[model samples]
Target: MRNVERFIGDKLQERKDNLSIRSLSTNIPPVDFCSNDYLGFARSGELKHMINSTLASMQNHLNGAGGSRLLSGNTRFTEETEAFIADFHQAESGLIFNSGYDANVGLLSSVPQRGDTIITDELIHASIIDGCRLSHATRFKFYHNNINDLESKLKLAKGNIFVVVESVYSMDGNIAPLLALSDLCERYKANLIVDEAHATGIFGANGRGLINQLNLTKQVFARIVTFGKALGVHGAIVLGSQNLRQYLINFARSFIYTTAAPIHNIVAVNCSYQYLSKIDHQLIHQKITLFRKALKENHIKTLSSESAIQGILFSSNEATKQAAANLQSKGFDVRAILSPTVALGKERLRICVHTYNTDEEIISLVNYLKELN
Candidate 1:
């Protein structure tokens, strides 16, 4: 135990020396910019009202799920809700998991077999990387959003091929070339699995995600959508064929071994979806437009992204952290994505534009960024 403590201390000291040490911070700034709540649904009083009202009408609502979904946690309402969400997304079926991370792990870790090849984007999320690590399959990473590189990997792949990518990258704030990738996968006879965590409530007609918006739902083998982000709720759903849902139920250790979410959370997910369909998503796009325009006018460079998620790259972790600190001081909730989270020298400020941000706020934030520049 003493040796283990020394090892941990040494790792921490190394991080501190490099100015990349991470610590939980409760000191959130007043303005909104850093969160995944792009539609402002997470902070919506109306959505809360709907959740509370729905919960009130239900009888015998359990605070806890009591067990995993395969056991005592299995409820008719949960199954029905999953079906409803699946139908909403135009998927043949769906299965719910505790989080986007769990869904990614559960699906990726279990689906690909020993002889299979799992090809992923170089900049795919940590959860997907972890999942691929857990799999017995051969794993390969292609250059981010490079279709030609992906095709090269596909040619080298063996047995069953699984191509994985995010619809919207969380850190880089860029949308994947889904159309091109879908065509490439079809040509290679590879299954394309998309993680739509960042695109779930910001794209599509009713936020059905990028695949649905692009009419590629039928082409995708599977999609993992999360409620914690734009839906401003919790939990996640893996959308696919009915057989896939059953397979995850039997084999996804993350889903089978873990307890289910509480009744309130499930209810919130349902209510949030209900709220999603009625809201004007145009407001979010409008904010994004305003932000981009402001950045351009201020001559502040940012990553090329039309999505709600946006980024400004910095050369070093220290520079990124200091920029975040400066923004926090100005009461904007911007955050730095440092090395290790991203490759060294690719540190950035990951900014999220929301429907709730005012025109003045957008301009002010960009002006500050200009000053920083």
Candidate 2:
């Protein structure tokens, strides 16, 4: 026990020394720049009302799912919701998971066989990386958003090749070249898996995600969409063919072993999807434009992203942390992405633009960013 304590203490001390220690804080500022509530749905009274109303209408008053989906957890309502989400995303089928992390881990760890090869984007989410770590397949990483590098890796890959990427990368706030990647996968007869975590409820006509927006739903093999991001709810869905759905139901340990999300959470997810069609997503695009324009006017460079997520790179973790602290002090609620999370010198201030942020607020945030130097 003492040895275990010492090991934990040493690891924490290492983090502290590197200024990369992480802690939870409920000290959110009043400003609306740091959260994943891109459409303001997370805080929406309308969404809450919808959820409550839906729950009230449901016959099942059970607080919990009782067991895993494979056991007593499965419900008609849950299966119906999955079908609805799959159809909305133009997928053949959908399987619900507790979270995006679970969906990624379960899908990646279960599908790819020992002789298979998994190639991922260098800047893919940590969840995907962890998923790959659990897989028996050989793994490779291509340069971020570089098709040539990806093609090179694809050529070198053996067995069933799986190419994984995020539609909108979480940290860098950059989008994947899905069309090119899909084409490459087709050329190599490889499978393409897109994690649309940050894209769901932020793109497409009814927030079906980037795959739907780009009309690549038929081209891609699978997609992982989360409700916690722009939908402002909890849970995730893995969209794919009916066969894949069945396979995951039987083989995905994370889904088969874990208790299902409660009835209330599923109701909230259903309500959120219904709310997606009514959302003025254009408002979010306007905010993103306003933010970019403000940044350009202030001559403050940011990562190349038309999405709601934006990043401003800093040379060191200390500088990035200080910038985030400065923004937080000014009540902006912006946060820093430090080393180890990213590469050592690639630390950044990850800013999220939301539909609720006004033009004045965007300009003010940019002005404060300009003052950071």
Candidate 3:
């Protein structure tokens, strides 16, 4: 008992020794190259005004949800938003969870029963990995985005199989081959689950996400969409069949036990989506294209990605951290993805482009990297 605190201190020291210790920073830099606010809606005064106006119309609006959805937390507004999201995403139903982490943890930990088999991309987000670890079913990882590797694993999988992937990977900013993966799922009789966190406000007709963007909504089994990224809000939703919604409501521990999001937060999410449905996707694509071109002109080697998430891999953690510091010194807020979070030799600086970013800023960012090297 006397030495219990030593273990915690030792782990902290390990992180420091490896240049992987993390700290939070509240300061937002002038140049915006490092936020998940791909649509710039997170800073939108329009969304704020809409949320306030919507809140004012509510009768006796409360500041807090007071209870979980299974208790006194559920409201008419919640049901309406869920239905709205389902219709927007072309899914049969939608269920809101506290966040992307909760949605993934809740679904993965509960949906796959004992004797089931779960297969996922090796580069899937950490939240999904944690969820898989918590599940009673067996889990396996395939090489990242390699269809051939996925099939090889699927061929040997037993019981009810679930295959998971991200429509837009958060680190590399590369998109999944949903059409190809969905086809594989069908060939193997595996359920395909997609995390559309980064694609929700930037892809598809009306930004419904990559699944609907590719006309593969019927091919995928489930999708997890989060508002905290492109939507510029908080919370997340699981888009699937009505049966899946019902099942999560009954069995998903994360959704069942947590206090529901406050009314104003829900109102904000709904307002953001209302704005998302009307925003110009073409204009956003123009920004993405512009940034990509800048990187190419500089001859800066980067991961092949058409999305807003872009990464420049460095050989070591120290090199990546120093590079990120150099960028931040010039007012770019790019972040370093150090080892353990990524593999040892795969350290990188993750740069996120937004619609609000000007051409000058994009050019400056790529040029800075070029000049630094």
Candidate 4:
């Protein structure tokens, strides 16, 4: 066999040995607990109707974006949506990207020039880490949520400094100390870039995100807001100054090269925001409270998180996988996170709670998890 084929075979065998060989699963679980659709917008018939009506009014009903935004993909409605997002998020301007990953890759890889330094939380999302790696900037990581360590690194950093962090961590589901981090950035004259992937549509008054909720929009340099999670659609936006938007247009390659998302997708995202504006977010908070209360009552020990993502650590990959399989057998979709995705000792059952999850479902899941523990 060819060397390339043999190398690929070896990697596949390694994954199988580790019990981490992943495959696509299209079957919807009986109990909803593992998806990122925290607000149920992805599953909403009302949102579908809104998208249909908006699309029907369009003069051009083309299925595709036609070309990249730099060429022919840019539309009046898309630009208007960007402006609306900027105004809603209290930013000076907004630029859309194909996905949250693209936004991070584009912004981080382009913004910080050579000789500039990037300081990030050790536990930031993989996209952020990839973006940082793509940049010409020198990068350093501090302990997760450790302000002192960040400051110490900041003192040692040279040239222009950009600090990147996720408002709510994707894996562990813990929130960063944004207020303090923003304060530190201000004191040290560093720009703060926050990826609100998990926080958007779950926090803030109108689901604007954690930055908006904390009133730190003015303090942050750039915010990457994704529609895939709580907003329940596709694509992401970088919110910042108009100059920053213009600069990214000139330099951010990911946004420049990719085919623009379809018109229907942008419409769906806009509709999700409109839907968010009218709904009562208190219902989501109540659900989170109830779920947390159940976990406590069942005496299930998991990572402390006020957000929708919660994780319970198990001793090994085998134990965590068995726990997840047991839950799956009982009609739950709870998934296990194993190394090298997480540290060896951090193998856990990552459970995501959503507004659509019923009270009975939450109780049953917690009781089963308690028994497993």
Candidate 5:
């Protein structure tokens, strides 16, 4: 037969040819700059205990859920997690998926019909884009956080429509004009889907997410919130009406075919919610305030973001990488988001403020950046 190895080799070559090849490697010992663990919950002892307690209650089934949720994997934990999540976000129901990526793919791919028009913000996550690609809808992208452009495109659409956006744009570390967009979607009879991947446990009153704090949960159609980033665990939930959730359970291939998320992972997420509800939110908000202060004090121009995500935009990728490298040389950990991940000319070093990040660390990192200039 024709060599099977050659086919695999050819595909690998395409990645190199297109300059899209990605390789994984371990990091050298350094301070933190490039992780999504905003609440520092990822390494928290409390969260560990929560997980331990959960493990104590259940079997240590670290193995695959063994089958899709509809088959044999669905359990009371899944149901309870979804129920709590829906109540937390003030939704009628919630559908659990294995990851934020899975949740997005399942929602966008299965929910939108062939005749539907999807108008998404250009700055939305790749998961949303992939989901839209799988969808049978006609899609359009408006400018990043530009509600006026969204309105224009929304006005032109004449069909079943959905407006997809992120509460906070990941790379740029900026908030969307949610109020304006929600108003436009209402005027145009379009459904709204907000992705809150970066806003959990770090924003909102009880960390229900930005949209939830704004009380816009009822105005939106669906929200995809992940536990990995802020909740310090894995999996995500799609919050919406009972009918919408039922529809996803029935039709979403990602949810239907993939193994359900492990039990401990679900429990960890629940623990995070409990912690957020019980903790001092002011302690976290103070970190955000101090981080913002350090950014301004250092005179490194940052976007006016109220959330934990902050950005230091350098002129070029080399400049961005160099800044991150310089930070690493010291004791700080900050990351540079490069081109294509963000559009050209907007590459940034994304700095996530968290509960564990001290005021001193924030000031020190900013001061270091100033010294570099």
Candidate 6:
């Protein structure tokens, strides 16, 4: 065999050995407790109407952005949406990115200088890890959500330190100890960056996210909010000071090299946010109430999260997959986050609750898991 083919074969074997071999597949056609569409805005009538109305106006931008944003892609709509996001999040400026992944990679890699230190929670999302690898700064990882551990490292941390964390941890379905972390950052004179991906459009008043709900924007350095999850579209925006925005535009490669996202991603995001802002309170409330009640009734133990994501721990990978398969056969969609996604023995079935999920649907699905898996 060729050397390249042999190398590829060895890599595939490694993934299999670690049980980390992922493959693309289609929907199993059950109640979706797996997607990131928190508000059900992905299929919302109002958002759809907004897009249609915009299209009907025949005021379309070009299909592709055709180049990097700094090159030829920057437009009135891009600037307009950036302003809207910044003002909405109460930040001084906003820089749109291709996706949450790119945003994280770009910001994490670029922001910290050569002598700076980035001490992040051990369980920060993968993009942050990749960004840290690409960055020039020294990196440290404290235990997840352990402020004391962070403080211990803080004692030794040198040169402009930037502490990074997520407001809502994706795999664990739990929040970071943000207030404590914020105060600690302030005390140490360190910058804080909070990824508000999971909390956006759920936690804060008007769904700005956990940081905004706790009013930590002024204290934190940056907030990264994505449109795909709660906002129910594609792309993301990093909210920060005008200085930070200008700096990223000058240095962030992810922003400079990649062709900008299509105008549709921006358009859909704007439409979705507009719908969410004016949405009735009862939309999420009734569903959340039903979901919580069902969990309580079934006694299906889960992590403590009032947000859209939920976790049901199952110790073994086989057990987790069997449970997911059983629920899948029963016409419910669920997936398991195996070891390495979380710590070993902390594997869980990551359940996502949605605003459009009906009371009956939640009840039936929970009961199905109880009876079968």
Q: Give per-model CA RMSD.
A: 0.8, 1.0, 1.1, 0.9, 2.8, 1.6
Question: Which model is ahead, 5 or 6, in terms of TM-score?
Answer: 6
Q: Please, what are the lDDT tens digits per residue for candidate 5 over residues 1-373?
A: 4788888889889756644345665764355656787777889898789878877888765555667788778888879988998998888999989999999999999988888899998888999999999999999999888888888888777578999999987877778888888888888889999999887776787877889778798799988989888788888999999999899999999999888876777788888888777677778679888877776776768877887788777777777778877888786777677776777677788887777776777778778878867
Q: lDDT (0-100) at residue 44 of candidate 6?
A: 86
Which ten residues in a row are the worst by lDDT in model 2? 53-62
Worst 10 residues of 5 by lDDT: 15-24
Worst 10 residues of 4 by lDDT: 20-29
CA lDDT scores, all candidates in order: 0.94, 0.92, 0.92, 0.92, 0.82, 0.86
Show model 5 residue runs off by greater than 4 Å. Answer: 1-22, 28-30, 59-63
TM-score of each: 0.99, 0.98, 0.98, 0.98, 0.92, 0.95
Native-to-model Cα distance after best TM-score fit, residue 312 in candidate 4, in Å: 0.8
**What lDDT tens digits, residue by residue, belong to model 4 across residues 158-220?**
899999999999999999999999999999999999999999888898888899999999999
Model 1, residue 277: distance off in Å is 1.5
Candidate 4 has a TM-score of: 0.98
Question: Model 4: how far is 61 from its true place, Å?
Answer: 2.6
lDDT of 1 by residue, 1-373 (tens): 6999999999999999998999997889999898898888889999999999999999978889999988888888788899999999999999999999999999999999999999999999989999999999999999999999999999999999999999999998899999999999999999999999999988898888999999999999999999999999999999999999999999999999999998889989999999998899789998999999889888888999989989999999999999999999999999999999999989999999999899999999998999999
- Candidate 3 lDDT, tens digit per residue, 321-351? 9999999999998889999998999999998
Judging by lDDT against the true structure, name the best candidate: 1
Inter-residue clash pairs, candidate 3? none
Residue 146 in model 3: lDDT: 96
Off by over 4 Å in 3: none
Provide the clash count, candidate 4: 0
lDDT of 6 at 183: 96
Clashing pairs in 2: none
